[model samples]
Target chain A: MNRKSKDGKILLLQGNEALAEGALAAGCRFFAGYPITPASEIAEHMAMKLPAMGGTFIQMEDEIASMGAVIGASLAGVKAMTATSGPGFSLMQENIGFACMTETPCVVVDVMRGGPSTGLPTLASQGDVMQARWGTHGDHPIIVLAVSSVRDCFEIAVFAFNLSEKYRVPVIILSDEVVAHTRETFVPPSPDEIEIFNRVTPTVPPEWYIPYEDTGAGVPAMAAFGDGYRHHVTGLTHDERGFPSQRSDEIDALMRRFFRKITQGFHEIQRVETFMMDDAEIAVIAYGSVARSSRRAVIDARERGVKAGLLQLVTLFPFPRRHVEKVLQQCRAVLVPELNIGQMSREVKRVHRNSSRVETLNRLDGRLITPREIGDCLIKMYY
Target chain B: MAEGMTGLVHKYLRHDKKFPHIWCPGCGNGIVLGSLIRAIDRLGLDKNKVALVSGIGCSGRMTTYADFNTLHTPHGRALTFATGLKLSREDLTVIVIMGDGDATAIGGNHYIHAARRNVDMTAIIVNNQVYGMTGGQYSPTTPYGAMTTTTPYGMVEHAFDISALAVAAEASYVARCTVYHAALLDQLIESAIRRKGFSSVEVLSNCHIQFGRRNRMASPVKMLEWFKENAVRMHATSKMKPEELQGKFIIGVLADSERPSYNDEYEKVREKARGISVEPKPPARFEG
Candidate 1:
């Protein structure tokens, strides 16, 4: 597992392996996670790699602790991450909210498996689409990215870190069982090829550093613990000076800034791939591994003389409403093929002006919705 | 205390922040906090290099007033956060403050596992016997048959002897003292922080407003008196029979031994992973 040469050498790598490589490349210095099926390889790879790179990898007591430790390391001026599946993801929601409220920059990679509970372990599902957005309670902001291919895993892991650091928010990478376990030929990006983003540190003296002051950009420079700033970070609603505040104005300002930072950076944060969308009468909007199948369906449909295109969502939350809306407007009908029962279609339908124009092809029995199944749905909707 | 010592302790407080504090008058949380500050001051610790991590409870508020690198984290999860902080910044002295319920109830798994992991950090479990901030509910350390809002008919569960739990979990250092024993509190906490590996100090403080009122020890003074009378010094406990020890608790160091802390061990792990061998430094507290 040496650092792959950047000489365009195509090496077969699992999605989880690529993600771990990307995180290390993106400067993730600490990883604390619990082992879960489909996601364990990410931790396994990190455990093998992080320590050798002078980074730390710890198998925390549980997912809750894993998320907690990641946030703690991030606050200590290190980029940190944790990976888990559905049940573990549920346990991590509280600390995810803690990261949101305190504006801690960290990455949470949720390798999606089927569930409301322990539904599936060795299976894939996009069921956590909603959970990734609203899993943590509260009206908080989050950034979520989905990886469809092994290459996307490496690139998206880096992208997730950048978004988290820039916004001081918890970024979630949604990779399902298929994407995580699938191995593909990937050319590792050279160090010079990847752009890394680190959180802005305060330039002011320790006496003048205000931990949470909204500095016009809605982002306050962070000072790590033991850096002489000696500032307070808390889960409670805090004022500009980072002390807990009960004042309505301060509370309102904090909430506004949390949201405004992401909303204003929407152009930078939102990413979607429009494939063969031009001159198409019908569109299929999908994400994660299902998007790979959807792309095949669209290609098969086009060969059969149907005016079909694919809208692959690389970023899932902040909802990607603008891209979905455009696809909806341009195409007479839209099909969303996913492993869950209408989880993502619910979002597409929300943005589609005409509700009846959008339909979903769902396969929920621990199996993937194949290209043929999706193509049939698209053809039926076309007719 | 001398005027000079008082000034040193006050220097560690965040004066310009929210003052007058949030504690109800006579609550023992302030006393435990005072003990902690004095202990740190005695050790001559640099405020900048000490991180006070606390979980949700009345005890958690102590981090807010401490003029150190403070983190007020989620309930029952301060140790988890401190574990990460210490692993990354081994130079900082990490001290975790949690309450009875915060440590033993919702956070029980972390409490035992943190001890087992033996990370170099001091955990001050301010055991007030009930959830004071959330209104009096029976906590894990709440005395059996003690009445509370949720346990009006008295509690059915036996109390957790927290210090014993730590000792059983093989923590490097473990001690117990009541807030009534303020001098002992300072001594035990100072030793716990100074020692390497996971150290736990169970400070039996009073939540008179909640736990005390139901048990007829509502006055902070009465609770202190109960602690004073019932707590037998560890040395003296050896002379007492099991029957004589009934309804009494022990105060003093319950466990003390040396072990490789998690941070130091992880450093070795890093060395192994990198295929590099270096002379390991003797385990000692990092000088600020």
Candidate 2:
């Protein structure tokens, strides 16, 4: 409980380290993970800090086990988390879906790196943008928050945990290599200023505790393992009794609710920062590290007398379609700069189909897409 | 933590839902589930304190029927999830039930590591020799020369000896049993549950409809009979090598040793965190 509070002053720390500090601030008591590059620092930080705080930290055999451990620990009434990179994140998808189906509250921090495989361990890439949205083979909706800066990494990590617990679903904090490795000044908030959400505990007796029965809040009240509330949770399509139901109607109803629960709150879930969009005829839509580069490009373009604006996406999963539509309605053309070969640009084009011109500026060779490149793309499109 | 014995009959078993257990009639999954329920009853573990974690497979269906804190996780990942449950709630008894395909094939890495760390949990693997749920596919435990839907002629690859694997991986208590030996299996399961470290009980069950029919033991009764005939006690099989029993099954306690369990060792670290010594007070040792 004796945490160091530095009077709201900025302290230099890596993005991964900031995430660890942010999770600690959000009351994360249990961390289970296997080491993977770029994201290993988060696990290392939690391994050293959690035990000292009377919490548990486990280096699991693999990423899959790490995910499983956190889910299990969460059921035991503790806030749990794990961190991984591309390959490990892919391995965790099935269990991530399991957490979704069961409505388990947990946080997974994915430090994005290159590839469909073990592409780049130390290099950064945003290729996992689509994977974060549709990685698991199911219709379940997920909440993914993208962090563009070291400070944003810390804030979003805390926010991810809060949203995860509030919705009784796993919240993913997506950070690419540029944001994960970059060191920046961040102020750790006092406990009073930080918002923390805990899983809703059941007040009903053991016999009356139906694990999957919703409280009309779309999230069922959870009972930790030793609290004596006997309930069942499964990845299979289950009815309100928490028993597996193979019936089509039951499966349909459950799947619909699962997607609707998160998708319905898109207005609340979506977070984007708009710059110079009110007066601009051209816009650049970007997220994560690319967003930072796009911001610089927008600044440079405005100085050069081009009407270019920036739409920086902070929450990537809900896609911020409404915002994209609004921007496209006003702008004549949209430029999406990313580290992948047109992943989010496809989504932008899909939403703004036939309404606006959409162009992509992608770089996948383990190099950071620079502001100059984005500026060049804007200049070419405008002039 | 409370030790009390109760009658074998489980009041929670749904009798109204008779017949069609969702498993093939000759499948050893039913027998394994019976042993599990009996063990729970014998241990008198509060139903509320029992958490059954399972991965995707035919055996995974046990979580649905068992009236307790059941977690049906993804394929081959039950151990990882159960590890979380056990470490988070040290008082609750966490048991993982998974099939051969789920446990040894896809989840093999987790199984070995769970054993190596000796986490305090019980893993019950229903080794039916084939992937029955996915339709007659050869599994990691499928014997050499065994025919399956995938392996039309015969499988040339060797089968995994899960008990031996667990023993080598440092599981504190490792045992093997067959569904035919119901009473003995119940006792083994109960002992494994009571063991203070990571314990693995490989139940050699039958997928009579798939593996059984493919291997010529078509009927459920005949499959159970084959298990009975092939199994020999550890004492009887001591002089024989694994190759000597190529087509046969050997069922007995494989390994038992004393090792510091993950939870007990974790508590020692916790005590140190609280500024207390983990070592008990010792008198001076005399020279021999």
Per model, how many backbone clashes are there?
A: 0, 0
lDDT of 2 by residue, B208-254 (tens): 89888888989888888988988887777879888877667767788
Chain A TM-score of candidate 1 vs. true chain A: 0.98
TM-score against truth, every candidate:
0.97, 0.92
Interface RMSD of each: 11.3, 11.8
Could you give candidate 1's per-residue lDDT for residues A1-383 as a string of tens digits? Answer: 22335443466788998999889989999999998998999998888878878899999889999999998899899999999999999999999999999999999999999887988899998889889999988899999999999899999999999999999999999999999998887777788889999899999899988899987779889999999998899999999988999999999999999999999888989999989999989999999999999999999999988899999999888988988888888889998888888888888887777834888788888888889999998889887
The local lDDT score (0 to 100) that residue B42 gets in candidate 1 is 88
Worst lDDT run of 10 residues, candidate 1 chain A, spans: A1-10
Best by lDDT: 1
Highest-scoring model, DockQ? 1
Give candidate 1 misplaced runs (Cα > 4 Å).
A1-3, B276-288
**Clash pairs (backbone) in predicted model 1:** none
